[model samples]
Target chain A: MNDRNRIPIIITIMVILLIMVIGFTSQQRERLTPVEKWIGDFFMPFQRIVSQGYYGVEDQIRTLIRSSEIKQENEMLKEELHHYQSELIEAKLNREELMELKNLQQTLNSIDRSGFSEPITANVIANNSGNWFQMFTVDAGERKGVGVNSVVIGSGGLIGRVYETGNTWAKVISIIDNSSSVSFRVLRDGDLQGIVSGSVDNELSGYLFDPDAEIIVGDQLITSGIGLYPRGILIGGITDISTSADQLLQNIEVEPAVNFNRMNKVMIINPKIYEE
Target chain B: MRRLFLGSLFFFSMIIESTFLSYLPFPSLVPNTTMILVICFALYYEEKNGAIIGFTAGLIKDMIVGRVVGISALTFMLIGFLVGYYNRKVFVENATTPFVLTAASTILHESIAFVAVFLMGYPIHVTMALNRIYLYQTIYNALVAVPIYFIMNQILHSHFLKKSY
Candidate 1:
């Protein structure tokens, strides 16, 4: 084959491959086959090694750039911490009294115990590189008992859920992705439930189950334990509230508790599997 | 043999983009290394080799980070092939070819990806993607192209590329 004639042949091959790939991918969105899982597992170690080196250098650079701001922030945070510590001591005493009352009430009425389990810690290996969508890879999978739909929590609160997994690695879809939706209730008003879903922007949105439900700014939102997530995990705080012109539903915005920018590690909740 | 080397390079580039680049200051503004590599190869290497490299690179990318596979594969492969076709007309040896090509091809790649994702039922915010991703990536890629091109040029001239034509 002459050099001049090679371009057309290559283009033909590429077109065929493109069509085949697109067709194959469109059908396999949710999970990967065993072979695909094996491939991902094989490459996970290299990704981990690279991530460690990358993060080490990254932290150094960031520290140098933000030293002055950090100093000021450190002092402010110290004062805040002292104030919060005093409040926490008081809250602990109230919590103890509440637990005693709850135990007495439980003795009077038979209630099933909440089945929340311990979490498996995992190191994040990779984050979203191409699109505006929020997704990440964590270095835990079937080996560590991380499975599909496992809820992941970061420093402050809920981060996301494990979307797909191999033998040694898992992919997490952040709560901010357009497709992810979490059933939540206003922590202040336990009766009010809604579905918090991701949108095009950074913030998340949910509609009040009752259009008349009063949603105030700064209200805390927590998982309602209806579907995927366990009940009572802090999801975010309400940042905005509004009603459409027709007033069919009240639209609310939530700011997630986890700061994705600083998240390096997460915990995957492993629900106990009851044997059939 | 050369294809294997390029394939691994592409894979390594993927790892870097996902991990290293994400930590950079203003990480969102980091250049698209995969696009840069593809365009550089398309501009400098033979048309056929460029397309094959681009296809393999995109597939590796899709396997790792993509929510829906093959969207990036189609986008990058097409960009590689189109840029390669114009290689004959463009002066590959010119100092500024890579910078110019990188700038043009970034827009082309992002636009194609946007269209493909849109077709796949993704509700993309066109203006936001255009401003945040496409525009910033183009400028960043253009800036990074100078160093990447020179390094790649050196590597090619050292042994991998022989002046057979």
Candidate 2:
């Protein structure tokens, strides 16, 4: 009974320590603690393998389901088919990304912000386990100049910010996370600004600072020079204006420009480099 | 053998849950099969081993997947202790034991996590958190518990089950 009785006392101490850890981690700490970095780095290889293998398996499963008739016909041929099918899918995906990259480049060029250093490209290595929070780890990290709050841009626009960084990897929390909020300026009318936030459903909703601001559906949005984000990064276009219970703050829904589902590669930019 | 097997199972579950489960067809579910693993051991051996397993599993998950560390660890640890403490009174072997316990634990786990994250100042919609995340995950984890429980029982029979009896 002594051992059994001691469990609660031991657990009480542990629970308190764990709570303190939770509080410390919740803050916007730029670098990973030594223990955290070691663990993260240790798991990096396995996570990388699993992420890649997961995609490969997904492609294989999709191929099998799409051609169930052919799949049942031959086991040997199925293996061969899976190979060719994955290759074909990978090539198609590559082309789509190329087009997206080209479009992003064109948009950046048109915007004419050439003072910024070249964006560090990072391969998304692993997605955070659960769907409740929107976060993913990328291969680029402190070594590549990617640090906390560095803006992560995907194919279309802003994905999120680097929440934490290791020597060779960084965890990015997307704008669509329930906890994340971004300040935006309506692109159509530059002075009309608001705060946009993400919800659990991977959707964005925001309210204008000025309740009387002239805003409508289909208006574009960009990052305002407030908060951690710098000015002029494209956010998304307004989708619908909802009649909220609170008339003091006019709320609007937004369709984020980045197609988060299909986003794989991202560019990390240090805000200080360009904000100056 | 028990130590080695349990270690492998813990590491395997961590990798699979974080990597493969997220990409599976269902988008809204987390399928926390690891919680079932903790519950099974707790039911068999009770709190002493249970708390350690729960804490270790939760710690791995937090280090890898969690945005906020210690939430899962704390919740899982407490759940393991509570489950073991209550499980000590009922020594019967029933098929539904693991299943029902897993379902209950999932809800408790998610609720603790939900409250913790919310308290940490994350804006969470109540309906979305309840309907989409907590409910969906509870069903998935409960369903997964049966097979996992049987397998774990089978594996632990020689070394662990014989000792207590």
Q: Which candidate is the best by lDDT?
A: 2
lDDT of 1 by residue, A126-158 (tens): 876355567888999988888788889998999
Candidate 2 deviant stretches above 4 angstroms: A59-114, A129-132, A210-214, A243-246, B158-165
Candidate 2 chain A: 10-residue stretch with minimal lDDT: A109-118
| Residue A272 lDDT, candidate 2, scale 0-100 | 65
Please give the clash total of every predicted structure, in order.
0, 0
Off by over 4 Å in 1: A1-10, A27-30, A57-114, A271-276, B1-8, B27-30, B159-165
TM-scores of the models, in the given order? 0.83, 0.81
Worst 10 residues of 1 chain B by lDDT: B156-165
lDDT by residue for model 2 over B42-159, one digit each (tens)? 8777887789888988887787777888888987898788789878876667788877888889888888777777787777778877787667777788889889989888877765
**Clash pairs of candidate 2?**
none
lDDT score for residue A91 of model 2? 92
